[model samples]
Target: MAEFIEHNLQGVDSAILAVPVALAEGIVWEDLARMVKDEKMAGNPIAGLIDKLHFEKNCMIEVVLALSAHANSQRWYELKKSQERKQGKTFTPHKKAFKLAEKKIHLQLSQV
Candidate 1:
């Protein structure tokens, strides 16, 4: 995962900085799924992140979406989980999912 992040971040410019924050802001799963399926952002890095979030866990769409939205940092996950608990939605995260999200955050932060 680290290798993948390093490779992807190479040659990437400052524009990537906004991605983590945007992702952190929270996105609807349908919108994220659409972005992955849409051809317009097929080769875009953000699309890659969307795709990674969707496919990495082999979980349901809702789970993937939740994980992706909470990918800003480890603390974000805890906060999101707290919010979900209050709202009665389950937000269980596997170790691999956290690692993937952390690596993604690291990659985006590196651009800054």
Candidate 2:
């Protein structure tokens, strides 16, 4: 999931199931919440919900949905930000760059 936030790589779907089950198996996720809080969400509003879910430790369907959505939304936000940076004038783009960037951003929009 670190790859998701920093690089916009939405690795595997297993973490959605694995995390809560790990919690039920006695894993402590305060570290995740603390790291998330410290890292900041870069503007994802629901990112804080994961911290609350960790406390409840219920693994209910809604909790699962919230966790999944939070992760997806965070990943989406990072991808969007990356697109913005790529579009900026920091460097010259090749002739096909606009077309390719648009296609990539389109894929980013479908992440959730």
Candidate 3:
């Protein structure tokens, strides 16, 4: 998990910072299933688990979006300032899902 986090630094950092509680437990299927389930049952759990997984996935998406937006906004400000000062404009946010996530995050941040 730590290796995965190091490999995906941006996502891991945001995830760690944003969902600290959830991260503490780690991303386990059964735990997540239980979290989203309406109740624990002895029989037929996949449907509930899947539904819960979807919900949890959406929640994580929201968190990712918000974190990306905040980081992007800060970086944008610093980059612009540096460009103005002729110091440098070296940082370039890559084209990836992280960029799209920032849009959702920006909206969330606005509400906050």
Clashes of each: 0, 0, 2
lDDT of each: 0.46, 0.51, 0.45
Instruction: State the lDDT of candidate 2 residue by residue for 55-102, as single tens digits.
Output: 574442223333454565575667778988987745556646877999
Top TM-score model = 1
Question: Which has the higher TM-score value, candidate number 2 or candidate number 3?
Answer: 2
Query: Candidate 2: how many backbone clashes?
Result: 0
Candidate 1 lDDT over residue span 1-112, tens digit each: 3233334443222223433344567955456456555733667544444333333543232232233323423444566677889665433456567889999999999999
Winner by lDDT between candidate 3 and candidate 2? 2
Cα-lDDT of candidate 2: 0.51
Task: Tell me which of candidates 1 and 3 scores higher on TM-score.
Answer: 1
Predicted candidate 3 versus true structure: per-residue lDDT over 16-54, tens digit per residue: 343345545685655655643534354433222222233
Clashing pairs in 3: 65-105, 66-105
